[model samples]
Target: MSDKKDPSVWQGFKAFLMRGNVVDLAVAVVVGAAFTNIVNAVVKGMISPVIGAIGTKNLDHYDSCLSATCQGDQGIQIMWGSVLGATLQFLITAAVVYFLMVLPMAKFLARQEARKKAREGTEAAVELTELEVLKEIRDELVARRRSEYGER
Candidate 1:
């Protein structure tokens, strides 16, 4: 009984990993990490300076002082400006991927699938022609008339 314990759970897990969707997800994760570096570079290199020029010296550095703290204990915080920049970068990356990659790929695949179905339907329809249908109707009518005359 122990030896005969179901292997289905392990088999299902193996099947899940082998599926194209799972493989594609794994690939996307790796590619997304690489793309994140590029997006971060673009945001930090270009957008940060522009924002900094318009505002404070550093976009990523913000400080808040607590109420009546001792001189030595004065709150000097370095709120993550770079993290904010990174967040923006991630948003842009997501938008680009959705519009440029996902949307176009989905549309292309849908069109291809539709075309394949249409071709298959056309091939199936080719077996029945208008002329053949008209001939079948004529033959049926002739047989009916002969049967009527024979009955008389």
Candidate 2:
């Protein structure tokens, strides 16, 4: 048999942990966790209270009894208010992320792209003019050389 040894598990684990994507994922997870708290707070504190002013303060308490014996958890109860609250939270989070982050980033990127295109346009015009001048000079030199040579 050959004398080559297999790599240890620790080396494999270390390589996995040292990967750039893994580090980025770890940072994203941490930031997501922190962001979750903020979103939850906004949903619970602001949205929930405003909605609760029209009904029960706790969305979990709002449910419909589908069966006749719904008293004391004895029948089928549809917790529609909880679902509505969850949906509202999702919408609010989406709107916040969109309006605050995504929209602004898109606008900034568009502005940057426009500036880049403008620069490229200006540079292209200058380059085209420079090329035309070089071609003119070449043609003029060739014409002068041909006239001198032809005359000789």
Candidate 3:
């Protein structure tokens, strides 16, 4: 029998979980879910009141009646308030995500890349300096060797 052994499914699954993208996505999902509550609260407790000043206090209360009498199927009522509430929620969520998580992370990554590039440039400069020093030492050695041989 061959001594080689194939990787188990568990090992493969573990590797998948360890990948950067997978871990980042998992973390984003958890944070996003948690952030959802804050967005909802902001829209409900803050924005809704401002909107209420202009219109109805609650979006659920804003509806249109299709029939002459809107009493339990006597007339058809189009509940547009719920749609407005959903739209408001969506906007709040998008704004919070962009400002808090995405923007800061992008700026941080840009800073890290800049630092890495600067370090690489410094390393290159040091290598060039080392090369110049070595060349100068080699030239001095050749000069000494030639002078001694000429005297002999």
Candidate 4:
């Protein structure tokens, strides 16, 4: 009988976890949770107050009653202000993450890629020059051999 054991499910799972993308995803989730707190704080502390200056301080309280005998929680209410506040929070978070993190990283990666391409191009140019010189030397040697053989 062969000595090798079949691959187990647990081994495959472990391999998946060890991949770079899985680790990066785990880090991204943790950072995103932390970033959420900052964005929520900014929306609540700064942006909400600015909106409050116009009317109500608490957006949750700013709702419209749709029923005729509407009082307190006894009505079909449209909570547009809460929706607006949530939308604002989402927009601010997206803008900050894009401008502060994604955009700068993209530019930096682009610069690194450009530098890599330039180095490769320089190496290729040097290799091409060397090839041309070798070809010239080979042609000169062939011509000299032909002339000697013709004279003989």
Best by TM-score: 4
**lDDT (0-100) at residue 128 of candidate 2?**
100
Q: Point out the higher-scoring one by TM-score: 1 or 3.
A: 3
Give lDDT tens digits, candidate 3, residues 64-121.
9988899876789999999999998998788877898789999999999999999999
- Cα lDDT of model 1 by residue, 35-111, tens digit: 88887787778777788787764655544445555245565554566567667877888887899899999999999
For each candidate, what is the lDDT?
0.79, 0.88, 0.89, 0.91
lDDT tens digits by residue: candidate 2, 2-99: 33333566678889999999999999799778887899999888888887899877788888989987888589999998898888878887898889
TM-score of 2: 0.84
Is 3 or 4 the stronger prediction by TM-score?
4
Q: Enumerate residue pairs that collide in model 4.
A: none
Which pairs of residues collide in candidate 2?
none
What candidate 3 gets wrong by more than 4 Å, as runs, is 1-7, 60-81, 145-152
Q: How many clashing residue pairs are found in candidate 3?
A: 0
Cα deviation of 81, candidate 3, in Å:
4.4
Per-prediction TM-score to the true structure, in the order listed: 0.63, 0.84, 0.69, 0.89
lDDT of candidate 1 at residue 8, scale 0 to 100: 73
The whole-model C-alpha lDDT of candidate 1 against the native structure comes to: 0.79
lDDT, candidate 4, at 75: 78
Candidate 4 local distance difference test against the native:
0.91
